[model samples]
Target: MNEIEKKIVDQFDVAKAWSHVQHLVEKLPGRYTGSDQERQSAEFIAARLREIGIEPQIQPVDSWLGVPDGATMRIEAPEPIDIPCAPDTGRGQLISGEFIVIETPEEARQLAGKLTGKIVVIPYSYSYPITPEEARKQGAAGMIYGNWGPSDVDILRVTAPQTWTYWGLPDPDAFRIGEQEAIPQGHIGRQSYERVRDLCRKGKVTGSFSANIRSFWGKSHQVIADVGPDHLGDDADFMIMAAHHDSWNPGASDDGGGVAVLLEAARVLHGARQSLKRKVRFMFVSGHENGAYATSTWYLDNHWQALREHAICFSFTDNPGFANAPEFKIEANEELMDFALACARDVVGDEPKINVHRANKTADRGFFGVGVPGIYTRGAFTQAQADAWGGAFLGYWNHSNHDTLDKIDPVNLERNARIRLLEAVRLCSAEILPYDFRRTVAGMRERLEGWQADGRYDVSGTLALARKFAEHLDAFYGPAGTRDAARTNETLKALARELSWINYTYKGRYGQDIFGVDLKKPLPIMNSIDELAHHAAGSPMDLMLRARIRRDQNKVEDALRASIALVTSS
Candidate 1:
């Protein structure tokens, strides 16, 4: 690290950041969306921003949320027995049906006709092959998610709420199904899951599940502030640093640590504002745990034009600074992977193990569809540790009452904050933005070629476009040093917007995909490539897919052409 970088890193006070985390976790427990505690947390964050001479804007956003109250489950068949359970954010109601364990979505589909009025028990994984909406459509009466962790008596899991609409909670379509028609859902521990499975092996098992939750539309606050020069005016090019402030059950690690990191980074960056060439927008969003990124979605919708025109990149922090997690994990888009990895190596020495992954559909990732390249950094357990703990990410205590202040380590917290500060300073102060489109095009070509090898569909034209784009990247970046920095940066940003739109989103630039649906594949629109083989040629389904592919082909080709035009024009 250089002298300036070292000086900025030294300015981050670990004690101050830890104090913030302690305050949030201890004084304000249960910072659920739209709750009084959440509002107070926003106020607390805003006050901190003001203390550092940055005026904060606390914007109110109306969102629909389901807050869990309590839940119950009982087996009322041959022998009456009560099972311990925790409620997901499904609707509140009592429903009884025959207990049927369907391990996978395909199994549920195979047993479609028999699923009506049946309570389906599905095992919990990171990504669900079948969602509650699909289960509802298949005529299932209720749902129970079997926790993936150990059968320890202390652990009870409640996951983030299920949302069918895009960007979560704001869409009118999400409310199209009335509460009367909604299905009740909850989670049972592994021991309960084993007992239920054994009971199902017997002749027939009848079970009753109920969840008491309060679902309503209310207002939540988002605290936003900017640190840097004002001379660039309204269309100033800026980068975003954001974290969600609301979390479940004294969520010290899930987001309290993230909030603390953002605060400390902002304070340190404010002192170096005069050295920055671009603005740094700090957003403390709400409604992540319960409302599914409602406030972040609100910002995207309200500021769509500005974000598309001037936003450079998006960086988010979540679930950082775990006590026993020695491994550093960096999740970034291909465009920013190289830069982000270098920053990680700077913070944690190059000798330590660092895990690199592609960005996914979590951690307030509302910026993806907006065409902003993003990066997320966190401390994570190694593979062996994760396996020993029953595959929990941070720990089995995640999103539970056990996520208390004891889970945070001061040393790890300082390391996380230092990494955030380095990334922010370099991104804001660099004369030329650090983005490599070559890496992006290489990934695109790989995905397209893999699809082409499948022989299910002809992606030759798209593959050619990707190759053509790749050939021009060297020439595009060759003259960057001698060119006008502002013009060159603008061209790169515009190209990124187009490439990210096609690479990350299937809904194009204007719409949002349904929340919690995995779109991790490169060029997610082409995911339909495998589906074409399922239907006979010239059948209705096949013809429909053909039409959709043609449109998507046009989308990809047009984006590549635009990218080419950008490079050549610059």
Candidate 2:
């Protein structure tokens, strides 16, 4: 580490950060989006920033928020019973129907027509193959997600309230092209699931499901602060360090830990502002839990021009210091993976390998559309813990009322802060933004080859472009650095932006995808390539699929060519 980085690390006070976490959990619990508590938390974060000599701006953003009131499920047939449950999302309506259990997507497909007017029960999954919207479209009255964890543990006790609305916090002015009717949704524990399932096999089963959720238009707040390079021009490049301030229940680990890290980092970085070559902006966003990243999306919309032009990269933190979490994980876009890992190794020795992954549609990843590469670092559960807990990376306490101050570890929290602080300091002080596009091109080529081997649509054209781009990148970063530092940095930034957009998003640069859906595949725009093989050639469906693939291929090619142009022109 450099002198400035070491100095910044020396100033880290985990006790101070722990105090912030305590305050958020004890004084400001239940920070639901757009609620009074959420606004108060925003003010609290702003006050903390002000205390550190960073003038923070709290911007109010209007959005749709869902607040859970209560939920209940009662079986009325084959033996009357009241099953404990947790509400996901609904409009405060009660409905009763014949109970139907579907264990997998295949079962749902087979019993599609038979599910009309019935309450369907399915296993809860992170990537829902059959979403609530599909159940609603099949004329189902309500949907019940059975907990996927062990039978002994009460999953409902730790599962937080979630929304089934695919398009979380829809655009107020945009029209819903094919919106479906809202359906009541709730979750049941494992033993409850077995009881309901066994009862259904004995005789005709009937149950009532209701969720009292308050849905309305409301306002959330974002606290933003900029430090370093006071005289920099409007278009001057800057790095973003962001974390969500609002969360479910006590949220000490979900984002309370992340907020503590961000605040402490800001305080330390502010002390070394004079040594930074670029500006560092710290952002605390709200509306992550119930609003589904609405506040972050709002910030992106309001500051598109400046962010697209001047934002060098984005680094976000979430659920940083769980008590029992021993695994350190880093998720980043390929371009930033090398630099981020180096930072991780610098702080936590290279002996314990860090688990690295490509960035996904989580955290405050709304910057993907704007072509801003991002990295998220957090302590995670070990494989044994994950397996025993039904594969929950953040443990069952995530987003739950159990996510309290007691779940946080001071030592782990301080380690996380130091790693992130080192990242921020190096990013701010670097001459050329630390980006390696060679990894980016190589990843694209590998994905294209995998698709080609599937014997699906011809990906050769895009694959060739990826190969060519790799060649250009190789020449650009030879043994000795280039003489034109300014041009080199600009070229690297432009390439990173375009390539990141194509690799992660399908809505081009302006639209937002639905929340809670998986879009982690390479070149998401062309993800439908495999579907083309299922249809017969010259059929209408086949023709439509081909046309869509061609269009998406053009998008990929345009981005590759743009990257090549930037590299060659520089």
Candidate 3:
């Protein structure tokens, strides 16, 4: 590691971070987005920024949020038995009906016909736990949601509460639902699911629930504080180091640990700010748990010009620390990832297995919508390990009350802090940003190949473009390091910006983070090409379908050709 980065790494203290997380998780209750606890959490983080001598700014975020009242669910048959319902915001949403249960999407597809005549019961497993929208077409009354803990024990899960799109943000006339719109729903524990499922096998099991979930317009926030010189050279680019502060219950691993790393990152960088070559902005964003991506989205949309001129975001979430034995990942092309990993390897000595995601999914989802190149990192474990750790499948403690401060280890926390700190330093301090577009070309090709395997479509159109882009990128990253830094950075940014617009926005513009575009995973641009080809050949309406698919195929082909020209000609 460079002398200055080494100094910053040595300065990081996980103990200090632990104290902060302890206060955030232990002293505080669940910090759901827009809750009083979340507001206080923002203030607390801002206060810490001040403690480190960085003036903090509290940026406002508006959202649609479900304010909880009370809820109850009970089985009327097989003798009346009460089942605990977690807090939700479906005011006066009461229902009584027979039910259908599903654990995975395949199961739901298999039972689609049966699912229509009853209340759909689904377990909280993947990111989405709601009854599939397709179920409504059949005629289901509503839904009874069940949450299972890592263990076999029944776990009560309270979801991030936002009914309308963009979490709780105000919507346009066409966009507004006017109220919480969905099949009326409430949650029960795992044991409740087993009981109801067992009774159904014997005979019909009818159930009743009253979801008194409430919601209103409330303010969420983003806390941004920077550590570095006020003025930088014209060529110098700034970097954003980010993590979410709000949590469900004591969200130690879900992001309390991540926030702790950001805190330590700021303090460590603050110490070496003068010597550093570039500016670093430390952001603790909210509205993640509730699904708005409120702060990150606001930043991307509201500050587009500034971000476009010069900014790359490095976001942190759900860090499992060293003990979790989690994997490291980045969405950028290979050169950038390699540079960052080399920096990380210098410190922790390769204990972390880092990989570059070919087709990006969830991570700092806020930035991609607005065209900023972003990198996200986290610590994760398998379901078995997560279960043992009292963590849900996706994270150690995703959205449960059990994610307390006890999950943290001081030494491991610092190690995580080290990985983030060094990467941010390199991005900020490097005169020429170390990014390569060939990785983008390569990643897209990989996704296309996967899609080809999934469905038989002639992807040669997309494949041809990927090859051309690859050739140009190879020319840009010269074998002798003879490329101009300024030109390379600008070209790479432009490519990523266009790619983001096409993948994440409507008409290559803005839309909802979750609904507007694919947030967790950005599918291939020609994702359905092969499927359309196969359908044209196999379907009864082959003539019409082929004609229509050809038109779209030509349009996408032209767009890809244009994008290739941008890099190739430049």
Candidate 4:
């Protein structure tokens, strides 16, 4: 390592960062957005940024904060047994209904038509959200979500708000519950859920759910720190270091570790600011856990003009010290994966080969949702977690109260900080942007064709255009030996600039956050196609939907056509 790199790396104290993690997780009540603890965390982060010679900016955002008090569930008929309940967004009213068990999504789907008027019990370990919207669509009156982990009956925040309208914006004008328009809901532990299911097989069971909760208007803050601003003068591309500071509990793994790493990494960048060719940004966002993404939403709205001009982001999260699963899944466009791996390797020994996995919903979702090229760093996983995911994954005490300071490994935390910091540094200093959209283009084409093969919908036209787009990509990228930095940077930026229009919400607003779409879909356009593919072949009533899809397809075609012209013209 160079003198500056070594000095900055050595300057980072994992113990000191862990101390901050302790303070954030244990000393505070919880990091729910708008809470005093959350705001204090913001101040602490701001103070740290100032200590490192960067002024922190706190963007004001307004929203409603939901504070769940307590809840109780009891099986009345089978046996008068009380089941512990986790509070949801149910206004704390007692609810009574016939209990039905849907332990899996497949089961939920199989019984969707029969779930009407019953109090449905479903697993919370869903890859996709199994919301009260589905429950309501199926005619369920009340719902109970079962815990996944064996550890404890975890308390959960409002489920529906996660869908879009309520949670997508950092600060929404009014407090909107979930997009699912949910009925009364509560959660149960696995053990309790199993007992109820066993009782249900033997005979009919009746249950009641009740909770006392409070909601009120409140505000939260977004903390942003800039490093390498001198280099980011007009015309230079920039990068963002991102993580969420808010969590349901201590949240050491979910984000406490990440926030620690961010602080230290920002310090390192601050010390070596002159070395960078681009500006480096650090963002600590609130409304991540409970409010859907109030901070990100407000940011998209308030800073659209400036942000629209920026290019890429580097996101970090889930830095659990538990080294059970050595592999980490980084969500990046296929083109950026190699650079991402190289960034990780530059930091440490690089023994365990980093693995790339599809994206998931996280703090970085905001950047990727808007078509900004970004990468997500997952926390280490346990063997159990590895098997549970069946691939490279992250499963730290996500949203659980168990994510305390003690769980953090000082060494691992430091390594993660170096990985993130060095990655940012490398990206900022690199003359040419490290992204190649050819892979992403090919991947999208393959996905479209794959879905078409299933006879779900015919995407031949889109597939053909994808090939043309790939040709354009090859032409723009040219042979590496023959291309110059300016041309490469311009070409990639133009590609991102156009692709975003295809991937993001209409008019470039954060409107797509309102949908319950998978962030791991690789291509947002595919998510849209997938969202409508099955329905497109359904009843005649889908004419409007099909028409809309046609319009979307037309837009996709137009964007691709324009992108090709932009690339070839230069």
Whole-model lDDT for model 1 versus the true structure?
0.82
Output the TM-score of candidate 2: 0.92
Pairwise lDDT winner, candidates 2 and 3: 2
Model 3 C-alpha lDDT per residue in residues 1-570, reported as the tens digit of each score:
867778777888878988888888777667877778898888899899889888999987776556556788888886789888875435666778886666665676566567655778776554443343455556776677666553366767766545323422546641343343455667777667777767776887887887776665667778998778656654456788888887777777778888888887888888788777678877898877763566776777776777877775544545547355565554443335566567656866866566555324343455554566666554445445656634354442346675666566676677667877888877777766776656555666776666557655556776687777788777766663666767766776676665654443333335543432323333333334543543446677565555655554464466567667777766
TM-score-superior candidate, 2 or 3: 2
Q: Give TM-scores for every candidate, taking all chains together and pairing residue i with residue i.
A: 0.94, 0.92, 0.85, 0.88
Model 3 alpha-carbon miss at residue 203, Å:
6.3
Weakest ten-residue segment in model 4 by summed lDDT? 152-161
The C-alpha RMSD in Å for every predicted model, in order, reads 2.3, 2.7, 3.9, 3.6
Off by over 4 Å in 1: 77-80, 102-114, 178-181, 197-205, 230-232, 479-481, 536-539
lDDT of 2: 0.80
Ten consecutive residues with minimal summed lDDT in candidate 1?
162-171
Clashes of each: 0, 0, 14, 10
Candidate with top TM-score is 1
- The 0-to-1 C-alpha lDDT of every candidate, in the order given, reads 0.82, 0.80, 0.65, 0.67
* Residue 216 shift from truth in candidate 2, angstroms: 1.9
Model 1, 441-559: lDDT tens per residue? 99889999998998878999999988988888888878645688888888888888888878887787877766656666788866777668667988998999988988988898999
lDDT (C-alpha) at residue 275 in model 3: 71
The candidate, 1 or 2, that scores higher on TM-score is 1
